[model samples]
Target: MRMSELSRRSGVSVPTIKYYLREGLLPAGRQLSATQAEYDENHLRRLRLIRALIGVRGLSVSTTREVLGALAEDTADTHRLLGLTLGAIQVAGETEPDSPEPAEVDALIEKLGWNVHGSAPARATLAETLASLRTLGSPLDWRVLLPYARLAEQTAVLDLDQLEGIEDPLEVAERALLLTVLLEPALMALRRMAQENESARRHADGTAD
Candidate 1:
């Protein structure tokens, strides 16, 4: 397809596509003539992934470029590829923010036997979130999250099952990123509704707010 066709098909502006090409986010299409280049389905797929990273996930252009680079590398191991992706997406070089819940979070993770690396960004995020909850005066018992962790484990199993049939590396990477970035808010919304329903059931008195 020509530039115009590529733009129309990918729903990206021609100028924006050219910018991506210049920035090395999207590889240049095949040269057909002095002024023409042809794009194929792979280009289209890459464009979609770029849009998802920048538009949906709100990653800066440089970060998106890094992620695409990681995805492009040949890696037969999905776990290692995912680790690379997470590392690329996470903000880097920040001193660890002081958090009071690191020990509790570490203990909970240990009890659950999660296979995450000690330096995983999610470990720091969990600790910071727990600390924030306490600072907000809504501290929760770590034991209360055991069931939630079990639910997450089941969901992870389902996710891995879905990925089992996918043989294409790019497809696997894009699907995993989409699931993590897009489904998080949907999951939180469902939890909120469930909490409302449970609160109503458990506190049935007329005076209950």
Candidate 2:
């Protein structure tokens, strides 16, 4: 197919496809003539993957490049690459210029007395996320995030339970990719539903008062 067909099929514009080709994110097509290039199925698949990584997962171009490179490697390396990508997206607690360390996060975990393993990525993710939230001026302290963290943990467990039954490696990878892409919207809708329910309850309680 020509660039136009590739663009139409992949839902990426011609200029953006050209830009990706220039950046070496997508491989250059075969030069069919002086001014035309022919693309193939590989290009179409790659363009879709790139769109998911950038548009859905919110990964930066550099990160997406690294991820695509990893995916292109031998199958043995793909799992490790996925782990690295997940770690990159995990939030660590906030840090400010000369800001004090998040002793509160540690304290909260300790108070909860949960047996968190040393060097657990979840801890680091929570710390980073809290840090980022603080940077964004979240007034509620670390305690406020505990419920959300518990909900996240439950959701992760459910997701793993569902994934455990899948047999095909490629299917597993595709499912993971799709889930990572779509989870944000799913979570947002759940939160919005909860908010509406809470508002209804509050209004009913006020009437009783």
Candidate 3:
């Protein structure tokens, strides 16, 4: 397809596609002529993935470029590919690095027998959240997280199960990113609704503490 056709099919503006080409966010199509380039299905797929990551998931251009770089690496191992994607998605936070919180998180993961890597971004997020809880004087014991961990494990199974029929590595990467960034807000909203329902069931009758 020509640049016009590519832009039309991708639902992205021609100028934007040119910008992506220049920014190295989108790879250049085949050079059919000095003034013309031909794109293909892969280009279209990549364009959609770029739109989803940037428009829907709100990733910065650099982060999206890094994610695309990881996806382009020749790796069929889904887990490793997921690790690469996740590593790129870690936005900076207010918490300082290299704290004792990681050690406590490690012990809790050991107790739960989770297969989470020590260097996973989620591990750092968990550690930071726990540290904040302590700073706020409402620290939760490790035992209190057991049920939540089990629930998260079940959700993880569901997440991986959704990728079963997807064979394309790029599609898998896009799905993984969407599940984490796009669907997460929905999941959190559901959790809030569930909490409200539980509160009503337990405390609405005036016998609650």
Candidate 4:
């Protein structure tokens, strides 16, 4: 496909596509002539991923470039690839943010026997959230979250199962990002429905799990 076709199919403007090409976010198309080039399926897939990274995730060009670098790496470590992509979504850096709940959060993760990185942004966010809950007069600690953590373990298994058997890193990363971020709203609604159902069941039986 031509760049114009890529632009049309991707809903990205031609100038923006060219800009991505120049910024290394999008790879160059095959040189057909002095002023013409042809793109293919890989390019189209990457274009969509770039759009998602910028439009949905709001990553800056440089950050998107870094993620694309991870995708293009020669290693077969899908774990590391997914980590970088998901970590970007969490706005993580090399270190956790300074907060009062750091130790508590670390202990909680250790108790759960999860292998999450120390610098994961979710860790810091959990710490900050605990403090906020205390300020709001509803202090819930990690012990209270233990059961929910077990549920989360199952949910994580289900989530990763969707990506099983994929070989294309670009496609895998794109699917992971879209599914994780885009499904959150629906996932929350499903949770609400389940909560209501469970409440009714417990009340009707006069017993709880």
- Which prediction has the highest lDDT against the true structure? 4
Task: Report the lDDT tens digits of candidate 1 across residue range 51-147.
Answer: 8788877899998988888777745878877777555576533224565577776778888998878888776777777777787899877787788
In model 4, the runs with Cα more than 4 Å from the true position are 92-100, 199-209
The numbered model that scores best in TM-score is: 3
**CA lDDT of every candidate:** 0.79, 0.70, 0.82, 0.84
By the lDDT metric, which is better: model 1 or model 3? 3
Q: Number of backbone collisions per candidate, in order?
A: 0, 10, 0, 0
Residue 114 lDDT in candidate 1: 84
Tell me the tens digit of each residue's lDDT in model 2 across 1-209.
99999999989999999989988889989999999999998788778777777777788888888777766663455455455445455445435555433455676677666665555576665656666666688745767767866776788777666667765443454456667657768889989978877887877553322
Collision count of model 2? 10
Give per-model TM-scores: 0.85, 0.62, 0.88, 0.86
Task: Assess candidate 3 and give its lDDT.
Answer: 0.82
Question: Residue 164 in model 3: shift from native, Å?
Answer: 0.9
Following a full C-alpha superposition, what root-mean-square deviation does model 1 have from the true structure? 3.3
Per-residue C-alpha lDDT of model 3 across residues 98-140, encoded as one tens digit per residue:
6566777787899988887756777777878988997898887
The residue-level lDDT of candidate 2 at 5 comes to 98
- Preferred candidate (TM-score higher): 1 or 4: 4
For the record, the alpha-carbon RMSD of candidate 2 to the native fold, in angstroms, is: 5.4
Residue 33's lDDT in candidate 3: 86
Error of 3 at 7 (Å): 2.8
